[model samples]
Target: MTADHTPGRVTGADGPAPVPAHGPVRAVGVLVPARDERDHVEACLDAALTALARLPPEIVTALCLVVDRSGDGTGAVARRAVAAHGHTRTTVDVIANAAPLRIGEVRNLGARTLLRRLHPVAPERTWLLSTDADSTVGPDWAVRHLHLADAGVDAVAGGIELDGPGRLGADPDPSGCARPPVPDLYAANLGVRAAPFGEVGGFPAVVSGEEHALLDLLRRAGHRLVTGADIVVRTSARTQGRAAGGLADLLRERAAERPVTAVEVPAADGG
Candidate 1:
């Protein structure tokens, strides 16, 4: 939300808009939703760009950063990243001040916009990958998803290793002991075909259950989803201050949806 002094689309009565970073991105459309993430945005973008760079230019579409009405520098940082790649075929741009479009709403908008803009020929085949701005995906992240898709699965879930403020403390709470096996679709490393996602009506609007809800819908619709540790990404352990309760909340939430358990969270590396 920092005064968008660049050059592009003006909101309501705003005179002129910053000329948005030029984009008609053609690769995998990576959509990231961020709020107050100034501290971690750089490394996060680094990982995303690195992964995007590894893809064939024709295969890698555009990386879209959705700024969620944050007063912080998240959007500004995203703009700069896109600017550096703007002069080329791959482009990145900020879809500014989309506040009312909280978490899932903004995410849906970002993915759908890129799907329409970049893949005008066949949006259904276009791949849209979603991740939190604070998460860092591995070098082969995009490739793995593409490979997974090529293998006939409609969706592929990736792995997440906790880091930063999310790491567990030493002398861990005994309740935090059991480590549950990773599931098939962690939001941090999620990827899907654009058509199925659109068909499912995007993610649930509810903040906490949106990702889970989407998975439920996909499963119910008979779309196959496979979770793999090879598709690794690291995530923040903090869940809006619910980290102390550990996986307890996750278990409680999932239990209502299906059978659940208290899987322990291993201490994050470098902890």
Candidate 2:
């Protein structure tokens, strides 16, 4: 079902009692933005819900699926996926943005919605985990973020593994050549502390590179940002994507190369 801005507790057929805003550790809000993602949305939600189910009993979680100008059945498919997974404690919110929104705008919409539902002090304890509709995370995704948060980390830039047939023969360095380091701040596997994220005005309204922009904002503010190779996510390798200059564009460029091995340069700021 679609979500509204109601003030009362949210409940579903198989959902547990409403979780209070106050708790030992703050809650987690997983935000996903999609457009015409009917082919991948269900699988993405399934993987996310599975990972979230592993959180501690005291840590509440919410899944916010923002369907932006989707002419297909993406929203309905996502709702059904949530129902099938049946996590009794995780609340699900489906937002329908009738007008087309940039990827950054859609992410901001979901984050703002979660922010409004959170307690004033919750930001310090809360975490915002973001991923894409074309990606599937590991089972320990939420647990990894929780661990980082407990360690006083302000943000996390996770790694990604490209998958699908499109990636089969698209090796950029076929000659086994070495290439310069590439940045790995993709939104498909990013986590942020609620406080710093909100303080930096969330994500910009740009259609691409918003993840890197947000990371730069957090770094400029002196937030503790870390990169976790263990928290890698599997994302689609298709050349066509929802937004221009996105992962699809990168994949297309890589496919045209002669295949090379590129090393990841650790962030100068340590994260």
Which has the greatest lDDT?
2
Query: Which 10-residue window of candidate 2 scores lowest in summed lDDT?
Result: 1-10
lDDT tens readout by residue for model 2, 1-271: 1111211112222333223233334788899999899999999998998898898877778888899899899999998888888786888888899866777888999998776655554787889999999999999988877775665566777777777533322324567875654566689999888988989999988889999889888878877666543467888878888888787887677666634444222232221
Cα lDDT of all candidates, in order?
0.61, 0.75
**Candidate 2 versus the native: TM-score?**
0.81
True-vs-predicted CA distance for residue 186, candidate 1, Å: 2.5
TM-score of each: 0.71, 0.81
Q: Report the error of model 1 at residue 79, Å.
A: 1.8
Error of 2 at 267 (Å): 12
Per-residue alpha-carbon lDDT of model 1 for 1-271, expressed as tens digits? Answer: 1113211111222233222232222347788877777766667777877787787766746777777777878788767765654335455767775456545677787787677666664545677888777788888888767765554445656556666333221333369865553333456678877767888998877655456678778778876555443556876655452222323254444444444233334322210
Task: List ranges where model 2 is wrong by over 4 Å.
Answer: 1-24, 165-180, 259-271
Model 2 clash pairs? 171-259, 172-259, 172-260, 173-259, 173-260, 174-258, 174-259
* lDDT, model 1: 0.61
> What TM-score should be assigned to candidate 1?
0.71
